[model samples]
Target: MQFAIENALPMLERTPQVIETMLYGLADEWIYSNEGGDTWTPVDIVAHLIHGEKTDWIPRTQVIMGEGSKTFVPFDMEGHHAVKKGKTMSQLLDEFKILRKENLAQLKTIDITEESLNRTGIHPILGTVTLRHLLAAWVVHDLTHIHQLSRVMAKQYYDAVGPWVQFMGVLGGKR
Candidate 1:
C-alpha cells in the first residue's frame, strides 16, 4: 500500500475545522457540564486533542523518523484536566487549533514511503504497531472526539427545546 502525504493531510486539516464548526455558539455553562458524569468538560476535550497531538502523535512520528524509541509513555487525561482547568473554553480551543496546525505541518514533512509505514513501534499496551496504524488511529481519534462533541451539543439542544413545535423544527421534524 502507498503511504502518501496527499492521502493524510486533508483529513488532518478537516478534524479541527469540524470541531470548531460544531462548537460554534455553544454557551460556556453547557460546554462545561458533566452531562454524562464524565470528567471531561468541553474544554477538557479540546485539551485532550491538543495533548494527544503533542504526546501521542508527535512522539510516534519521531519514532517513525528513527529519532526516538517506540516505548510509549502513559498519559493521564485527568492529570491533563487538572492542569488545564484554569483555561477558558476559548483558550483551550485556540491552543488546540494551533497544536493541530503544527501537527499537520509535521505530518506533511514526513517521508511517506511504504517502508516508513511498515516501520514497527511498541506501544505499551498494544505491543508492536506499524506507522500506518498509528497515523490512521490519530485520524480516527479526531473523528471520535468530534462525534462526542456533537453528541453533547445535541443533548444540550434537546434539553433546551423539549417537545415544542420550535424544537421539532430545529430537529427537522415535519408538521
Candidate 2:
C-alpha cells in the first residue's frame, strides 16, 4: 500500500548486506545444500535474486515510466543457472550487490512523483501494471527471497531441533 520510493529504497539497499551477513562463513556445503529435491539451495536463491536484479525491476520501471507501449518480458525464474553459469557463489553475491547499487542509484536520479508513480504498462503475465505496484513488488521480492534463504538455511537444522521442532515455527514451517 505504500508508494514512497524513499522508504522502499532503504530495503532494497540493505538486502545484499543482510544476506551476506546471514550466510557468510558458512561452509560451501551449506550454501549449496537443500533439504531434498524440488527446493532451492542458498546458492540457487542468490542466483534467482541476481536474475531479478538484471531483468525485472529496472527494466519494468523504464517501461512504465515512458515506454508504456512496450511489453514487459516475462522473467525466467530458474533460467539464470545457464545464463549465470561459471560464477561462484561469491561472485553471485558480489554481482547482486553491485547491480542493486546501480539500480538504486538510477532510481534516486529519476523524477518520482504521484503522477509518475501512477503510470502504467503492460506486463506479459500480470496484464496492466502501475509503476507504484512494480516498485513495491521490487521491494517485496528481495525480502521474500531473503526470508526464503533464511528458511532454507534454518532447515539445515530442522531435525537437529529434536522435540522442540514442534514449537519452532520456522522448522514446522508455520510462518
Candidate 3:
C-alpha cells in the first residue's frame, strides 16, 4: 500500500492497544517464552517498541528536519534487554503507550509536506535516507513485531497441536 502520513497514523496510534489486546494478563508462558536461540520473547518485543519510541523514530525524523545531528545515532537493536529487566509486562506496555502518544503528538506538530517528507538524513549505518522512509519503517516495524509476537505465541502450542501443525502456516516458517 502507498505510504501517507494519514494512513500511517492510525496504525501507529493503535499499536499499543493492539499489543495490549494480544498480550495483557496472559500467562507467564506466553509472555516470557521465545522461539529459542536469540529470538525475542513477547516481552522483549514490547520493550524494543518502547526503546524505539524513546530513541529511534522521532529523533531521526528531527535529524532529517535539521533539528538535530546530521548523522543519526546508531540504534541498539537489543538495547531493550537492559531496560526491561525487573519490570513487569504491564509496566512495559504502559511506558510504550505513553511514549508513543507523546511521539505522535510531536510528529503532528511538524509542518510536513511532500518536500519535507523527501528531505534527507544520514543514518550512521544505512547512510542517507529520507524522512518518509523512517516514518514508513516505524509503522512496518510495529507490524513486524506484532507478526513475530503472534508467531512466537502460537509456537507455544507447537507440540500440543501435533498433526494439526501441517495446516498452520505460521508454524511452517512462512515469514
Candidate 4:
C-alpha cells in the first residue's frame, strides 16, 4: 500500500503536465471522439480521476480512519462523464491536479499499520474489503487511467498525421 501511494505521486504530477502540454487548446470535438470506441474525452478522463480521488480514495481512507461510514457507494462512470463533459479541458485538468495533490498529502499522513490494513469497508459491489485492498486498487486505478490517456493521445496523434504517417513506421503497424 505504501509503495502504491509513493509511486502514484509522480504519476499524479505528470498527469497535469501532460494535459497542459499535449491537450491544451484542443476543441471539444477532438476530446469527445468516437474513434476510441466509447472511450471518454481527455476532459472526462480527468474528471474520472478527480472523482476517484474524491469519492473513492479519500473517502475510503476516511472510513479506514474511522471518520466515515464503512458502506461504499458504487460509482457511475457514465454519469460522471456526462457531468464532466460540461467543463473545459483546462478546468477538468486543474481540478484533477488540485485534488490529487490534496489526496497525496493526506495519504502521506496515514498510519498504515497492521490495524489500518485490517480496516474493512462494505463496498456496494464487492461487499467487504480491507483498507489495504482499497489502497492497492486506488493505485491500480491511477495506472489504468494513465494508460487509457496514453492510448487516447496516441490515437489523436495518428488521426492528426493521417494514413501515410502510419508508414513512417514508428509503431510498425496501422496507427
Say which candidate scores most in lDDT: 3
Q: Tell me the tens digit of each residue's lDDT in model 2 across 1-175.
A: 5569889988889999998887767798789888689898888888888888889889888877764376788888777786458978778888888999998998888899999988888888889888898999988888898878877887888888887777777676444
Say what the RMSD of model 4 is. 3.9
Q: What lDDT score is found at residue 113 in candidate 4?
A: 73
lDDT of each structure?
0.73, 0.84, 0.92, 0.70
Clashes of each: 0, 0, 0, 0
Full ranking by lDDT: 3, 2, 1, 4
Task: Mark the regions of model 4 whose C-alpha exceeds 4 Å error after superposition.
Answer: 1-14, 27-30, 34-37, 67-69, 82-85, 157-175
Q: What's the lDDT for candidate 1?
A: 0.73
User: Compared to the true structure, candidate 3 yields what TM-score?
Assistant: 0.95
- The candidate scoring highest on TM-score is 3
Candidates, ranked, TM-score: 3, 2, 1, 4
Candidate 2 wrong stretches, greater than 4 Å: 173-175
Give candidate 3 misplaced runs (Cα > 4 Å).
173-175
> Better model by TM-score, 1 or 2?
2
Which RMSD does model 1 reach against the true structure? 4.2
lDDT of 2 at 15: 95
Q: Of the pair 1 and 4, which is ahead by TM-score?
A: 1
Error of 3 at 113 (Å): 0.4
Candidate 1 structure quality by residue, lDDT tens digits, 22-109: 6646777667764467546566778788778778887777776675577667666655565476877677667778888988887778
